[model samples]
Structure formats: C-alpha cells, structure tokens
Target: MAAPATATILSDEEKAVFAELRNEHEKHRSVMIKMDRYYEGVQRLEHIGLAVPPELRRFETVVNLPRIAVDEVERRLDVKSLMLPDDQIANEDLRVGWEYNDLDAQAPQAHKEAMIFGRSFVTVGSNEEDPDQPLMTVESPRHMSVKIDNRRRQMTAALRQYIDPERKTDSATLYLPNTTIWLTRDNGSRWNVTDRDDHNIGRVPVVMFLNRQRTGSWFGTSEMHDVLPLTDAIARSLTNLQIAAETHSVPQKYVLGMTKGDFVDKNGDPIPVWESYFSGIWAHANKDAKVGQFSPSDLKNFHDTVNHYMALAAAITGLPVRYMGQQTVNPAAEGAIRADEARLVKNTERKQVSFGASWGWSMSLRERFRTGEFPRNGRIRLEWYDAGTPTMAQRSDSIQKLSGGTPILSREGAWDELGWSEARKARERQYFLAQESDPYFQRIQEKEELNDPSILRDPVQEPDHA
Candidate 1:
C-alpha cells in the first residue's frame, strides 16, 4: 500500500517537495499492485465465462487454464556480480570505505534488492573506527523524502521518518544528513516535533542507485511493469480456455418435440430425471433420436490460444521462448543458447554502469564521513564482478592475454582480472618473493626462466649435439 497522499502536512515551502514525492509514491504503488496481481496468478479469475444462472455452472464443467508466471527475465537480469574495490583503494581515504561495508558478504543481498525493485537507495555514515572506510547503508525509498537539484541531478536534501501505525504520531525520526540544524529551523514543528530524534550522523547521507531509470523520473523503473500486461492477458486467456473445455465436454442435449409427459409418469408425478445422463433409451415404434457429438475443436482452440499469447509475451519481454518451457522439439545447441542470452547480457551491462556509479559515490561519501574533510580528488570506484562471469578457462585465457600484451599488465592488474581478493593476492606475492630468494630453488628458477635443456647437463660434462 502507498503512504497516504497527505502523509504529512508540511509548511508552504516543504509542501511543494512533499507533493512531488507523494505523486511518485502513488505511481510506484500503482506499479507494485499490478506486479502483485501477476505474481498471484489471479488475473484470469475475472475473465472466466459465466452462465446466465450461476447454478448451471455446477452441471456444466468449467476449466481453469494453467497460469504461466514465468519469471526468468528478472532472474536473468539480476544475477549478483561481485563489486570489486578499484584503484581508489590506493588512497587511504577510499581504502577504508571499501572495507567498512564488508561488501564481500553484504553485496549479494544488496544486488538482489536493487534488481528486484529496479533501484536501491544508499546512505553514507560513520563506522566504529577508521577514515579509510565509511559505513554505507541502504534505505527504503518508501520511508524517504528526497529533494533533488534537477539541473544537477543530485539530491539537495533528504528526510526519513516513520509514523506510528496506531497513534499516528511521528514514532521514529531518522534525520537526513542534509537536514542540517539550519534547515530544521525552517521546517519548524514538522522537523523537531518528534517523540524521537537522531543526532547528527553527518550531512544528509542519502543517494539513489537507479536500476535502469526511466525517462523524466528520479525513481528507478522496475521490469515488473513491462511484463505485467502480458502476464495478465495470458492468465485471463488460460482461465477462459480451461473453462471452455469443461463446458463443452457435455454439449447441449436435445430431445425431439415429444410430449412434456415424456418427462413425467402417468401418475402425473415427475419422472426421475438424471440431468447429467449422457445416454438413455426412449422406446417407441417410430424411434429417431441419437446423442450429439462433442466436437474436440473448442478444447483445441483454447489450447492454441494459450500458446499463442504465451509466445507473444515472450516476444515483448525479450525472454527466450525456451525458458517458458515451450521448447519441445529438440535441445538447443550451445551457440543457440549463447545467442539467446546475448540480449540479457547487454541488459546486465547497462545495469552495471548505472549501479556502479551510485555505489562508487556512496563509498566516496563514506570516506568523507571517516575524515571530517572530503578528499579533494580521489579514486574510489566499484569493482564489478564479471556480469557474464566466465568460467575458469575463460578467465585464465583473458588473464594471459592481458598480461602478455605490450606494456604488460601489472601483477595487481592480472590479479584483479582474475577476481582475486587482496588477501589472496598478497599471500601469493609473498610466496613468490620468498621462492625467488631461496638458493636451493635458484637452479630450478634459472632453468625454468632460460627454457634450455643444457642447464640439466653436468657442469664437467660437454653437451652433445646429438
């Protein structure tokens, strides 16, 4: 459910911003409702056919077609790629920020939320210790109120406060980093008239990481909105199709214009009637009646319609038709499978770009939180795990190519490409250096580096040119 339009009655100035936010909230909520309907698989319940008398439905069978709530698009697009720390780690300020979040464990969950909702909002704040790393947090957009500098496309001010479900009073207040004491004075009672207050956690510490943003909107767009129509149409079609089968299984029975007494006994009492009786005998000298055939066309039509709509849905979403469990003839070859995934790969790359920028800035803000002063210029960037996530062989091949190039890639560069953690790389480096210094292994190292068989010959013996 969306928060009430008049969730808060702000002063004249704040009113404008609140109005905009309320508008956004309503749209987001509307999208959410449609998405919920798709997931529940009940979109067809309303479209099923109904007889004039509801009671007639019992005798005439009604079928409900299967609901194909295929959700591969979201899954394929949202696979969590590791967010690696970038060169900015070389700077003391940024290094701390990278480690503070303990992103190794936290990233999978964060990525999942952002992908599911099409966006995730983050805030920067202090950690227990260290300036190198600042604490970054993800806040729910539902509880947030943000003011944007449209031209700058940045958040100018932010507020997050929750009201009591029962008393309706502001039960909790989370002061935005930007809601300074000065701004609070202007907001008046709306700002400080809270039962609870949070002291300064340092400037308004909120930012948005849009999941594939839509045109002319601050909120991220969800994939759910795109597929909602298809899901609804398919579900409705399925229900009607299934119901048609049962209804037609027993076609309309007919009796000749025989007397009404044919249904009654001579005592004038109504003869026992089995309405569902598909077969019976009416003995007469001039008999001429036969059971009507139930043509299989109706059921076939419904089945075909369901498949056609499902194919259309697949087309609209760019989801592979094979994923719908409709690929029945033959298993696809590796090349075909890769081609099918090409569009999804491109989609994921786009997400990486948008989300990567947001995460980078969030880390920068965290570094600033650690040190009261913001670093003038710094290298702070997210290390995105490979979206394609190549197998071991692919990674190794790429690593070799990169390292063997002109102006060879640094050891650090190779390690990063290999997705090695700093700790693991450090251990490997230490072991490498130790081996180089060992006299016992010096001959082996020399021969390995030289790649000459002559080194294996005895020092006193002459090498034979066999």
Candidate 2:
C-alpha cells in the first residue's frame, strides 16, 4: 500500500500516445451525441425546427420511443450481487467496494448508458483514505474511450476527458497498465501534463461493458440504433397529428368573390385570415359573396400510421405492444403476458451475461487495488436477478419442487434462486441452525423417532441370525 510515484511531466512518447488515444476518443463523440439526443427525446425536435413552419413548430411533438425502448430492456436487468463458486454468500470484500461506490444506484445508470451508447466504462483505483475500500466509478462513453489489444483481448490504454466550464479549460486522464497521466489545456493552449502516477498494477484499470457486441468488433452495437429511425417516424407522425388538430380540427371555410377589406376589424386594420376564420364571425357588405365549408381532416389515419410504426418498433426490438402504448380491451392473463415478454426476457439475460463479466472484472480489479494481489483461485461470478416476470407463487412452487427432498439443489442454492440477498440468506441460515440446535426441538424430534413403527420393529430378534 505504498503511495504511487507522482510526477508533473510526460515523455515525448507518452505525449504522442495520449494524443492518439484522445483522437480515437474524438472519433466517437458525434455518434454518442446523437444517441444522447435520441435517448433524451430531442433528436426529432432538432429536425422539426427545420421541417416544420415557424408558426406550427410549437405544435410538434415527440413520442420518445427511444427512451421507452431502451428502458424496457434496461429495467429487466438487475445485478444482485457477486459470488464465488465455493462461497455461501456474496464476496464481502467486493461488496464493501460496491457499497462504497454506491453501485446499487450507479450500476443501473451504467447499464442504461451502455445500452444507449453501445458501451460504458468502469474505473478502479486505490482509495488513499481507506486502503480496504477501493474507489470505483461508472463512466459514460461520451467522455471515455479505450484501446484494446485484439490478440490478447485486453485493454491496453484508456482516455477520459472532461471540460471544466467554470475554469474555461479541458482536462483528460490517460490510463496505461503501469502509468496514469493527467493532462490539461486552456481554451487555446497546448496540452500540459499536470500530474502523472506510476501505479504499475499490470493491467488497465478500466473495464469496458459492451452491449450486444458482435464478433470481431471492438465496440458494441447500441440498443437505440435500430429503433432511432422508427422513433423519428413516430415523432413526425405525432407532430403532424398535432398540426392537423391545430389547423383542421374544425371545418375550414372558403369565400368566393369577397375582398380583403371585408375582413377588416373595428380598428380599420386588416384582420388575419386565420384569425377571422377561427373567430366564428363572418360579415361582408357584398351580397354576391358566397360561403362554403370543407369537412375536417380525418385524424384517424395519423393514429393508425403512428400505431403501425410503433408495432414495427415493438416487433423489431422484441418489446411488447403494450410497452409501446398499445392497449387491448381485455387485460392479458399472466401466462399471456409472460409469453409476450419471452424475447425481451431472453435479451435481458444476454445483456446480463455481457455486463456481468465486466462487473466481475471490475470487482477483481478492486481486489487487486485493495489486497495487492489478483483473485486467482475460484471463479468470480456476478449474481443477477431473474429477468423473467414470474409470480411469487410460481417462483416459490418451482423452488420448492426443485429443492424438496432432493440433492439436486442445496439449501443455499435454493435461497439464491429465491432472489434472496446475501444478508437475508445469512440471517435465515442463522435462524435455521438455531432452530435445529434448540433443546425443545431436539426432544420433540427424539420422541418422534422413538415412536416411529420402523424403529419399534427394528429391535425384533432375528430367527436364524447368530
């Protein structure tokens, strides 16, 4: 636990490496920004300002399907705890670090960001104030990037940048396996090394979580990518529906052979045509002028079009129709609801598999930071809550059947399957062992054993035995 060596200067080679990694990070900025806009429901509004007329732009609406699509999948993924094969409960050392970092709240944020932007990062470092609890943080892709060695399948370097608006400067941290460099620059100044730390941990402390990554790809695919276009379409449809309601919800009227002067107000100024039409009063001195009305536009087409795109989005993203705001007259039965969510549940499980590995790696890094040694013996695993939506009765029945009078599943394993936290399971275990050791309970058990017919018959003398 000696403090890492710190310096205020970087070598020429290190400077070049930092520059390259920063440039690589810059390459993903635009894509992440666009994804952010979509996730925040602002991407379509940007287009509306250009496509919609100034007066009608206010009526433009956003359906926010991207957020819904991402959230539907994100809500199903919940990492409960970390465990090793031989442990009855979660790893206490890792749990300390996890709670120290408030990961119960932050982990979901990281997961959602990974889903939105294809990847997110976790950085692990030693906490100088408390050696036993390491510092862990979840980083958004918007500000971080990593360089991976394809052959080794490891991150060789990582860069995290931040803009200090209050100071009117920008700063970045470049992470290497053995060194960490901090650089800063003013609005127009060159990059200067503020400080550098040589920790020599032997591996990059950044853990990258990829969402739905394909083979041979360095970056994962964003969950919002497929739904973005459909989301835009839905927004446009809703905006148009809003515009139609504003302009044509009421019957539009036409006047033949009428002069502009006929629509003048009491102030002798010409009243706007729209104002006169909506005012519901038409007066003219010309007797020959004629008036006729056109029927209001049918808005059902817009609703149908929006619903069509929503259905397509639901189908493409494996989201249920109800999640897309489509409702049925009859409430679906529990079985039907579960069936509709099968694909989504499966997809969530896949994400859990992917993110779970990164989390385990991060916690392992935390252990290294704390104990100065890597976890090498048992397999480290992250325990995730069941992604499927099963009723309590159903879950209980299933667990009972699996653990009842059989060695197929251990008692601890049954508790794990029941979604009990490590703390709760530990408490229950204590109570169970206490009950087994109780004198009254032991006496009752002995009495029951003595009165059993099998025990009474076992004492019978054997006829032919020696």
Best by TM-score: 2
Which whole-number lDDT from 0 to 100 does residue 351 have in model 1?
Answer: 66
Model 2 segments beyond 4 Å from truth? 1-6, 44-50, 85-88, 164-168, 186-188, 254-292, 329-331, 395-414, 427-466
Please list the residue runs of candidate 1 whose C-alpha ends up more than 4 Å from where it truly belongs after superposition: 1-28, 35-118, 126-135, 161-177, 180-203, 214-216, 249-292, 328-335, 375-379, 389-455, 462-466
Q: Which ten residues in a row have the lowest lDDT in candidate 1?
A: 61-70
Every model's TM-score: 0.63, 0.83
Top candidate, metric lDDT: 2
lDDT of 2 by residue, 388-421 (tens): 8866675566666888845565788768767888
Name the 10 consecutive residues with the lowest summed lDDT in model 2: 1-10
**Candidate 2: which pairs clash?**
none
lDDT of each: 0.52, 0.81
